[model samples]
Target: MANVLVCIKRVPDLGGEIRLTADAMGVDDSSLGHTVSPHEEAAVELAIQTAKDTGGEATVLTLGSEDAVEQLRNALALGCTGAVLVEADAAAYGPADVAAAVADVVRDHEAAGTSYDLVLVGNDASDTGDFQVGVRLSYLLDRPVVAGVSTLSVDGGEVTARGGSPDGGTEVYQVALPAVLTVMEGGVEPRYPSIPGRMKAKKIAIDRVTPTGEPQGSGRRRLTLPPAQPSQVTVLGEGPEAAGAVVDLLESLGVTR
Candidate 1:
């Protein structure tokens, strides 16, 4: 039996009008439309493509409030076999706490005889972009993890992943089964859900699990936008003299001369 689990998150649409309240703590989600986080979106696409390729089942899991059901439908519409929703509010936990919650979910699944051959997650959340969840989750689950995966494939109980490094190069890795992978954005292009798929996914049932940890980080500090940089102005000079002045100005500004 081939089983796969994909973890996803519902995030506010950055393109839409997003406002920071006076408190600067949370987002004004009143008029904000929500979608899967970009990294998570890519994970879903990879999950769907993997399922199609291997002819296996894919399950998506998320932890959110009641409204998070929409995220499940979104994943199902992308062709997941099932969805699991860990019933927690939006501000439920910090990264550490969320990792614990996911560990509990994995334990519950294991106890219930639901085993997974592979677990997938996004590289990081859009808001925090800590890039720690997948690594933490792997440690919690006692599984090997490969982060920053741009290409992934499974064959005969072995998995091969190609990840991009900082120096514009790709590294290939091979690992055994029961591993966790965090996918990057350029791994694969996501497919649009068909109308029929959307309708079917809407009616799909989501299993709700009560996570162990009470919402952590709810009392944490709020969000604050970083100071914006001023636009650049170019000063023109005459030939070599102008170039020397430009170099001097760049050196004074601590920029490469």
Candidate 2:
């Protein structure tokens, strides 16, 4: 089993209608629930599986408010062995800021005489859709990074990854361990947490850490939602009386005259 560290973000559950904030800097998440993206869910599943395969442990980490623990616990319930919380306002941290923060944690682990063989992150951010964190983190830690990965397996000191290419083909890579990877969804199906797992996760302790410096900030101006696509549904008629109308409608379309 490989010692794995998987980073995740807490994002608004965008399943329902979205309402933008007055400043347009973000959505009105005050009333919205929170969860991780499907991509991160898969990453979590992969992390646990990788650790189990290599005889190591999987750790889930996040930089967010106190409530973000809900998501961490969700991963724990799914089988992560440990969890870490970097207490900070996630909305206030930009890609570069959080990347540095994660790097700090990695260094801390090394200084404590422990190290992880793999670091995983969602290929794209859930709320912001930014694809910069994984690359930045790997740079800060001076590790090779593979992005947009859909599947991966760890064997001894090397990890093999597969992803999609621009030409609708598959791109495969075999990189050494102590690597960073950004995972995308679709290659594997995430498993649900069992009742026993959930109960066990609730009892495990989550390690907490705080940011050491102020965020450098971002130049992002605003967020804009695309215009809604127009759609319409027409009902021809109902029951027995609709047959003639349906035939007439088809004839109007030149299908059945």
Candidate 3:
């Protein structure tokens, strides 16, 4: 049976307008809501389904504040068997630091007789947009790695991954077991937790660990939000006289020969 690990992040919900901090170093989440990143949600779903198919267990892990337990529990509600929380201020750590802490957890788990057959992570975190954690973790763990995977399946100790190519085609990769995969959104449809699932998740205790190590410097000075795009509308005449204007518009748009 395959043992799977899915890593997730708690990010500000982007359903509303995003506001930045005064120094532009981070998002102003005081007025915003929080949820798991979209890609990570799909990763969690994929892990749970894989475990169910392979007759194994799915475990969710995250590196963030104690409040991140909410997200871990959410994963459990979606059918994860258990969860682990590496408690720390997520904002204080860079991609390398996060990767190191996750790697440490994986090693510890493996030493304790629970070697993971697959480790899943989002292609990038929604808030930080950092894409290094999965690759860094693979390097640290000496495992094969694949990124931007939109579909995944395992059979006979091999994993088949499929991703979209820029050329409007598909790119496929077949990697051995015990690999790391960075999942993108649209990989799988995430399930909503039912009332019974929520109750079960609330009763499950999360395994908490305090990450011990110095964080690596990211060398990032600050963050900057992009300016909003401006839109414009053109008005034509309002009558039969507008016929000529319509023709001109169609010509300009190359819709008319």
Candidate 4:
């Protein structure tokens, strides 16, 4: 059975209005809820299924503030067997810093005699749109890596991954074990947490580790949100009195005589 590790990130929920921090260095999510980054959610699902099908186990890991445990627990609720929290103030982390943290965790885990045969990651961070973590981690680990993979299947020590190509056709690769893969969202649908699953997840002890690697410099000076488009609406009468206005509106659109 192969052991798999999936790296995930916690990002603010984008369901509501998106605003930047007062300093313009980050998202103004103080008033919004947080969720697992979309593609990473799919990576979590893929890791679970990979472990199950191969008689292995899926471990989820994240690097961020203590609050990131919420996202970790959510992944656990979705069926990950273990969770690791590399607690740090990630407000200033760039893609390189995040990658260094992850690489350190992989090496530490391997040194502890827990070898992960497969490493899964999201194609990019939804909030910052940073896409280099997976590639950088692979370089650190000196392992082959693939990004934007939609689906994959493991057989023995080899994995067959499939995704879109630059030519707009499908691309497939047979990568050996001990490789890293960055997953995209279109391949797998993440499952919701069941009541029992949530209960179990609450009781599971999370492994916390301090980062041994120093963070790379902050990658951004500030953020700027796009200008909101002005919305215009005409009042059509509120009741029977508005019927005439509706007719006039339809007539203006050439839909009525």
Candidate 5:
């Protein structure tokens, strides 16, 4: 049976005002409620759907404090076969650090003889928005990486994918298996957890494993808000004189014609 690993994160709700530790390196999880990153959720759903199609199991992994288990459970509810938690006392890591930790987790799984056919992660996490994790993981795994994928299909050891383009067009590519895929949101709407799914997920067992590697980037930094700016008002021109005034105002504002 094909095996897949879906990576996810527990991030602060966007609606809430998030305050990072003074270090600015880590989030202040103590005061924030957690929710799954939307892009990661889409990746998980795609993994689950792919598993259903390809005949295998989708395993979920996350690295954070114990509270992150909540988001893992949410993944379980979404039909993942099982969950693994990489525990850390103090949640702190930059993109590079987090990527290293994640690579270690994948290596652990590989060493245990539980190699996956594919590793799936979001194009970008919601918090830091660093989009390098999947590519780094692909490098660590020594596998081909297809990123910004919005659609995916696997068949007979070959895969096909589509991604957004800088030219405002869609680009598609085909690659071999054992690849890392960074799924972009809007490929598919993530399935909502139903009552039955939640019930089953709550009962599903989650295995805890000791996380590998030291936490990186623990140095503290200050929190500063952006400078506020006054709002601009648009005044409609009524005639030639009004239009000339508007032109003069635009020139004053340094807006070139």
Candidate 6:
């Protein structure tokens, strides 16, 4: 049976306005809610579905603070068979470091007689926007890597990953087993955890591991929030005169013939 590993990140909910920290080095999540990154949520769903289809095992992994276990448990509630937490301060590590740490966990698990057949990750973390983790982890694991994958399936030890092309067509890649894929959102709708699922997840033990080595270096100086876009409201004439202005605006916007 195929063993799939889906990596997730705990990030501030992006549904609200985002603000930077005092030093502008990170997000000001103090006033925001937290959840798994949207793309990673899809990855988790894909992993669970694949495992269910193949009669395999789906494991969720995360690298973050102890509190991040909440995110891991959320995956369990969604039907992952197991969970792992590489306990660390996510903000202190860069993409390379996170990749290395995750690679270490995969190796350890494999050595312990659980070799993963597939590894799924989000295309990029919501907060950091770093897109290198999946590729770096694949390189470290000596496996084929597919990024921006929207759909995937496994057959006879092969994985078919489909993604979008610039020309609006689909790009499909068939790779051997034990591959890595960076999943994007919109491939499938993530299911909500039921009350019973949450209760079971709360009882599941999360395997926690400490990172083996220090971060090599992030090469990041600081974060800068984008400036807000300027907006203006034009005053058209009152009553009937406004209709002509509205029509003119619609035509200018190419909304009218």
Best by TM-score: 6
> Candidate 4, 87: how far from true, in Å?
0.7
lDDT of 3 by residue, 1-257 (tens): 77899999999887647788898778888877789889998899899988998998999999999878889999999999889999998888999999999999999999998989999999999878889899999999999999998888889799999988999888999999999999998867889998899999999889999988878756678877678766576778888989999999899999986
CA deviation > 4 Å runs, candidate 4: 232-257
Candidate 1: tens digits of C-alpha lDDT, residues 1-257: 35788998888887734577777877777778888788888888878777778887889999888888888998898799899998887574777777778878877887998877778989998866778988988999999999998778888787898999789999999999888999888878888889999998988888988887465663568787666657587766877879888878888889893
Indicate the worst ten consecutive residues by lDDT in candidate 5. 218-227
TM-scores, each model vs. reference: 0.84, 0.89, 0.89, 0.89, 0.82, 0.92
RMSD of each candidate relative to the true structure: 5.4, 3.0, 3.1, 3.3, 5.1, 2.5
If ranked by lDDT, best first, what sequence of candidates would result? 2, 6, 3, 4, 1, 5
The local lDDT score (0 to 100) that residue 209 gets in candidate 2 is: 98
C-alpha lDDT of residue 201 in model 6: 96
Model 3: per-residue Cα lDDT at residue 150: 84
Q: How many pairs of residues collide in model 1?
A: 0
Q: Between candidates 2 and 5, which one is better according to lDDT?
A: 2
* TM-score (C-alpha, index-matched) for candidate 4: 0.89
Least lDDT summed over 10 consecutive residues: which range in candidate 1? 211-220
**Candidate 5 local lDDT, 1-257, one digit each (tens):** 46789989888875535556766666676766778778898899888988888998899998878888999999998899889887865346766676677788778888988888889999998876788989988888799999998888888797788899999899998898888999988888999988898899998788787756666653546555555557686766677769778778889999965
lDDT of 6 by residue, 1-257 (tens): 67899999999887647788888888888977789888998999999989998989999999999989889999999999899999898888999999999999999999999999999999998778889999999999999999999888888799999988999888999999989999998878999999999999999999999999898767778887678877676787789869989998899999996
lDDT of 4 at 60: 97
- The order of the candidates by TM-score, greatest first, is 6, 2, 4, 3, 1, 5
Candidate 2 RMSD computed on C-alpha atoms after optimal superposition onto the true structure:
3.0
In model 6, the worst 10-residue window by lDDT is 225-234
Global CA lDDT of candidate 5, please?
0.82
